[model samples]
Target: MVNSDSPTTPLDSPLARKNPLTMENFHKFEKASNGTTDSMTAPSATISSTSFNSASLECASKETSTIQNETLKKRRNSAGHKKDYNQTLFENIDYLGCSKLNDPSNEPEMLDLMRVLDEQRMTSAVTVSLAVPHSARGFVVLRDTTGIELTSFPVQRIRFCVRGRLDSAQKHCFSISFTHHGINGEQTHQCHVFRSAQPEMAGRALYCFSQAFSNSGKENMSDNEKRIDYKFEAYLEIRENEGSQSSPHWVLCPQQNNTLKLRRDRQKRLIVQLKQVQLCKVFGPPLTVTKCFGMLLAAGRNLRHSDMQLLELESMGPGANPSVYVINAIWDPRIHVFDVLNTETPRDSRVFLTVAADVIIAEAGEPIRFRLEAKARVFHRDERFYKLPRVALREGYSLTLEV
Candidate 1:
């Protein structure tokens, strides 16, 4: 139950086991002689050094392998029976609203969790409750059926996902992880492991958390500010008048497998990506105009650069592919602007977090100007123009960009 992104690798915990001949010590350590000798070159025991070393290696290998096999077997068999701290944490939570695992055995242990939270809540006024968007507040349970109140945290603080698959693998168990912020601002990560066979319960619990997060999005804008959602429809409307004789184009490199393909839609598109673009961060600053839609998603915006954990997932699409619209991107090779190169990613283990950006032609309010300010004058003024839509900016909203 250590507070960390990844816990002990699955089935690696030191649990009680039934071994036939229990040695005084479960592990063997080969020590170097009383000097600076190599660890492998242990003192010659009885026979030739070479024979003795080989025998030791074989014996050690057998011992370690046997232990690993038995440990894994025991852990897999006692899935729901291990009543460790993680199990207690999982069994006691009042997720979103409803109780998660209301086992009778949990009645006694709930006191410890509540006492710890009560102490923390008394630390200072700030510690009384989690500071999240207004929609996600007041989730703590001071008293419950278990005769003890459970500590609550905003659903926005969690990074999690559930299996959308309808297979045996959907065990109604998903991981809930969060970084515990200590009293003095220290950080410790924790991921709760689910062992109970409550597939339906687990799915519903995850849904509640995700739904709460979905409602408390980043677009919680102020009275004067505006948030815009973009739909990149222009991807399908590159060229409508061209006939069937004109085919899509491809630019392939001579040796490498790198290739770029472009396709045009037969209908008209009102919005597409603009060649002039800027990159913005989620937690860094305030933006005057449209924020990356990913900033509005909990998992996307909460992912910290310092965190190393990754959630491996497969897209539910036919081939788990990136969006087909990326093929319609217009990039300037001369300026090093590039498009997303859709490649064959049969197995990528890195967590695939996305921030969906839409291209919009901002037609009003000074055209959202941007430029490079440099002491060294530009050698070439390679300026480019963007043809924005004819529509005027909304009456109360303004388009803005940061460079």
Candidate 2:
């Protein structure tokens, strides 16, 4: 056998151009192979058992080496494989993009909701209740206000392309689009847009809350990781109805203007209330709501105790069943913001919810509209609501209905 590590002169090498394949070299190689074959096929019976054992061990070692070499080759080939840059990307976060209209002929009767959510009022917090009474279904947008009458139109379809613009002031932008029953027929699709100075504010809060809510599952994580582009999201309820009956308190739809003018005192209180909403979202503990026995149970996102003012799952009301007479609105003004507990993610997080107050209940299989009085966030406050959609459990919410 030749020593692989030993250096050989070009003249003596078999691969040398000077020594190309020749009859002599071929004969020598053929003889060597024949000898090896004969040796393998016929064993020497006269040899001692010790020699036989040694031969068997040598053969075993060669087989193992071949297997090791084959495995190494496989690993090396795998390492050289190219990555697929064109692979589809899956989104783990909620829809944080703005919706673009394909056609505007069909429009949603949206409220000049932004009139109430001005720059000064953004500071005030509104308490939101879900599954309430006598309400309409529509989404609100928190964009830079036009400083005039609100713009409302029926929507056809919503596409996922978050194209945003900042005015000369360079503020973030946002909007609201939802799926609802068309004013005309089954083929008709409509959405509503609201007027505001800070459109993206609501979405930002919702996204922030989603991150925190999902992270809550992994207890004891560092807070530093949570700080991304999000500001905050906490609570809010919204919906559309009866041509959205009793929507005047919060939204200013086109037809309602002649009959319903916003009261000065109500707007003033809302400003203050919206400001308090900011406080609760930042300093207050997270409200973790669970679904058990056809009811949403509220608790801290974590297992730890939390501040009062907000009710626990054992105590959170607007409960599985509420008084129909008083609790009959998507955004009922009768309930105080504080008593309602949550607000639209006024710079608050929504975790697993959307800005379209009406869309939320419908997709949740509840089919109800939620209205906000002051807590920038708005949600319905009733348990047994209209349309009665199949309660869709999403985000991290459990589908299991515990008895």
Candidate 3:
């Protein structure tokens, strides 16, 4: 038996140094002892050992790097996470019909119509009664000054009586005229009244009569003309010759120039009235209508429970300065002086205006003087003017202008 452990020669010293060595000197000895004269010529064995050392070092470095990155990622995620209880509550709760929450102040208010009217005149009265039905069939009667019977000439004496269902959803209309008719051997003119949506009152009904006419030429009648013309004169009694009926008749007359009036009689009701107006200038130019109108610059603040009115605007470009138009505005009490430019950013930019602020206008046209200072700052003031079309919106109240 050979004693492999015993150091018999100097060549065995190299083998002993290579075995069970520390990591620092292992690479040094492995490189030094490789491809030597006294050592074995095992090139494949040397290559395998070198490759294993390099691979082990690479794996260890990568593992250390992964561990450090995981630790950093956890720290970052934890630091960024914050529990917002308000946001969480909003998310958890369902708000299907939550429009009232956004604008609680705009709720409709009850209104009393009779309280606004003055009923002072009771003597020498004109009593007009209108029987209106839910199914759109109705009639209006105008009593005479003595309140005895329907007038002989109802159309000439009585004005129009417009009656409809008290409810806001119904539609009704009425009209009347006079036409000539022959009864028995006498020729006379009769009145006709037309009612809409009522089959019973859809046709023309008798209303009044016309007067008589006399022939001017009778001496120039020849024998042929005498056979055809018998010089007959017929007089139409304007007041008499009428048939009485129990059914109610609607009295209509020519409307006076400015005597008609409208009365609103319900709570939370909407009334639309039309009036004729003569105007020289009409719609103002919209921002989209003309691009060369130029730019509008505005600065103002928005406060809670208040309207931000734009006072002044600086218009730029040639000719007359364009008007400043308000596009859209809202008040946020939490944010102050928020940059109007970057309001849609992901992170909240605390840009808002303080209470009671005025904007400076630096161009021509009418100098804007605002009443409310708390209104939200208008972006496109000219656009606002364009949106609310009609000259009435631009100028307050009503007046007759002749042009």
lDDT tens digits, residues 1-403, model 2? 1112334322233322333322233223323222121110110111112212211100000011111111222323443322211111111111211111222121111111112122223333222211101101111112112222111111111211011223312123222332222223122111122222343553343232222222212222233333322112223222222223445333221112111111111211110000112233333322222222111212123221122122112222233322110111222234453332333233233322111112122123443222222212333332122333321111211121111
| CA lDDT, candidate 2, residue 24 | 31
Q: Which residue pairs in model 1 clash with each other?
A: 4-189, 172-199, 236-265
* lDDT of model 3, residue 144: 29
Model 3's TM-score against the true structure = 0.16
Please, what is the whole-model Cα lDDT of each candidate in the order they appear?
0.24, 0.22, 0.19
Model 1 off-target regions past 4 Å? 1-134, 138-147, 161-170, 183-186, 194-198, 217-403
Candidate 3 structure quality by residue, lDDT tens digits, 273-332: 111122323422221111121112222444442333222222322223223223112222
- Candidate 1 lDDT over 100-204, as tens digits, reads 112211211122222222233222111011112222221312223444322333333343333212243424333344333333434433333232245555454
Best-fitting candidate, scored by lDDT: 1
**lDDT, residue 346, candidate 1:** 24
Name the 10 consecutive residues with the lowest summed lDDT in model 3: 55-64
Off by over 4 Å in 2: 1-163, 167-172, 181-185, 194-203, 206-403
lDDT of 3 at 327: 19
* C-alpha RMSD for every candidate: 26.1, 33.2, 50.6
The 10-residue segment with the lowest total lDDT in model 1: 54-63
